[model samples]
Target chain A: MSDIRFQCIKVEQLDDIHVVRFADDKVMDPARIEQLGGELQRLSDSSESPKVIINFSDVKFFSSAAINKLIVLEKRVRAKGGRMRLTNLRPEVRDLFGFTQLDSLFSIHDQQSDAVVELTTK
Target chain B: MPADADWIWKIDQEIPSRAEVACGLIRDFVEKLEDAGWNEALVFAIHMALEESIMNAIKHGNANDESKLVRIVAGFTASLFQATVTDEGEGFNPADVADPTLDENLEITSGRGVMLIRQFMDDVEYSQGGRKILMRKHRG
Candidate 1:
């Protein structure tokens, strides 16, 4: 068990939405990404399928594996008629999305409140 | 020469957590260099190089088999930092990778690792049937 401590998940409720904040320095590892996917799937399986707001405030690195997992999460959320919004992207992390041209594919915001509002509006 | 300046670590590729373990080792190396007042650009470059090389070993070389071994070697001198990653799997041709910026390949999900590695490193080279990569960055 490595001592790399990551605040991996934070589930908060704002009205009907579920804000799942993944605060971590290294969110790109395959194991951690898969664990996140499993958690998201479990959350989506519940009777209350609330809109999701993903906070990326603390994430500084982005890996293709992590992006793939998020794409899967997005598809799952949309299949349930809910949406996922990302927030608080650091510049370097944001550049990864831009490099893949996925910046347009995801709904991103500079602020958590903004992302929460956008998710609820949809 | 500072103590622990020539840190080198080698591990088998069969470990399921090799990537994380390798990254941790490189991070410690970079931190030590940074503490020695190494240039920030050099540190960032080396960090990206280490990441891409390790990822290639994990994803491409080992094919995520968890049965193969990926060996990493890292060294630093007063002027330059160099690292090498070698995998146990059969090597693939690096020339076969297509340009991700091409119009038809724009939507592809893969092929970004090598490109990023080349972009960030001062020098990048492959060897031994494409199973090994040597990357270096110089302090400015």
Candidate 2:
């Protein structure tokens, strides 16, 4: 139980949208999911209309725990009157979302900048 | 490590506090997977599947009790990879979990894992009254 590594998630403001990027090249581990959940909680609580785009360009794989965290985060965001979406998902990630049918629940786009554009426009 | 040997481990620990312990072991296993012809994509799938399965074993199966043991076995062939995780706890019926894609259940957090397990792996089956999960992925 000695080995533990936290992937740093950086949030940047792109106009009105918040672009949250994960430092991990591939974030499928539950520990990293919990860490991202913490960050999402803080942001969800603080922002009034956080048009968020979770950048997953660096994340090649993720587990169900990660999706659970996103679901919780989406709930919190909606509770706060904010809109959220996902962007830059790898092909595998997109397929996973499609299989789970979660892709229907959240708005997904191809790129982060494009998501920001749409978020600000909407 | 040749492809003939099967890797096995007994997880006698709780989750969240020691989930990383399980994850680290799996990561090292995947690192060795390259020698077995598992590419980056296949390794990614195997890693994610193992993580989700092990977590479910400890968290949901054992109820995060350190006293229970979660037995894990992993192996890979030339074009296929498989792993199984069996836990020491009462299991639930998979049918009991609602479809996560449904509009009403979109916000629910529990079903995502089961869904992801099915999506990432080529085949997923539950046995031992749902206490153990066997998953396999085929290399492209």
Candidate 3:
């Protein structure tokens, strides 16, 4: 009854990269993280091994659970010789990454195009 | 700091459905505290503590069984907010939980909740039964 729905996850193939954009409230809710993990796992299982771009512009709050799930997704992507990038992070959420010292662990970009450029160049 | 600002509430645990209702009640309580001029950090700390305690009661104490009961008690003073979550299940050994900070466990998913609670709360105390946790946070 909470009406807690996750943003739509759109997977678009940009050449060899997969751009996964979350289009809903980016709050850290356990149920939403589980669903996101499921989707990421499905994509990772495929043989294409595309670069992953997680667009976080729509997310406002960051939770430890969501961060943990992101770490899992990062590991999965790395295992397949692919890289994970985050883009369009709000300042508050970005501060969370900084607080957690995860800024060094993942590639972050101010714009989606910048993330795309980084992935293409790599 | 106003006098007579302290408040307390207690409820028994049920299924996640009932647990959610408890969460709602706690959320309302926190909102009321915020309206009373409690700082943001204390409010956030209370919210986190409440969520963690309720989840532990529902998942670990009741083992997700609807029949089991979990109890939560919360109190706030002018300088500190305290909460206790107790479950009906046979308690767990806190020492048995692996150190989540170790490099080997960094990628592991499950053990981080307790670590987060410890980090976020100013004080954390566990009873031998392993079913009860008392957490507190102070206002800055």
Runs in model 1 deviating more than 4 A are: A1-7, A47-50, B1-17, B33-45, B64-67, B76-80, B98-111, B138-140
Error of 1 at B58 (Å): 3.0
lDDT of 1 by residue, B33-123 (tens): 6777776556555666777778888888888777677777777777767777888888988889897656666556677778777766778
Ranking by TM-score: 2, 1, 3
Angstrom error of the Cα, residue A63, model 1: value is: 2.8
Between candidates 1 and 3, name the one with more favorable lDDT: 1
lDDT of each: 0.70, 0.75, 0.69
Displacement of the residue A106 alpha carbon in candidate 2, Å: 0.8
How do the residues B1-140 of candidate 3 rate in per-residue lDDT, one tens digit apiece?
22343443333433342544654666676777777687655565566567666766676677777777777666676666777788888888878989766656666666555766776688999995788898888778
**TM-scores of the candidates in the order shown:** 0.74, 0.84, 0.73
- List, residue by residue over A1-122, the lDDT tens digit for candidate 2: 01223346777767667777788766756767788888777776657766788998888667777778888888888777888989998887787778777888888999877877777776
Instruction: Give candidate 2's error at residue B60 in angstroms.
Output: 1.0
Residue range A19-55, candidate 1, lDDT tens digits: 7777566665667777776776766665245487878
Report model 1's TM-score to 2 decimal places. 0.74
Which prediction has the highest TM-score against the true structure? 2
Superposition error at A98 for model 2 (Å): 1.1
iRMSD (Å) of candidate 1? Answer: 3.0
- Candidate 3 regions exceeding 4 Å error are A1-29, A43-47, A55-64, A86-117, B1-5, B8-42
Question: Candidate 2, residues B66-120: lDDT per residue as tens digits?
Answer: 7777888777766667777888889978888788778888777776677677767
TM-score of 2: 0.84
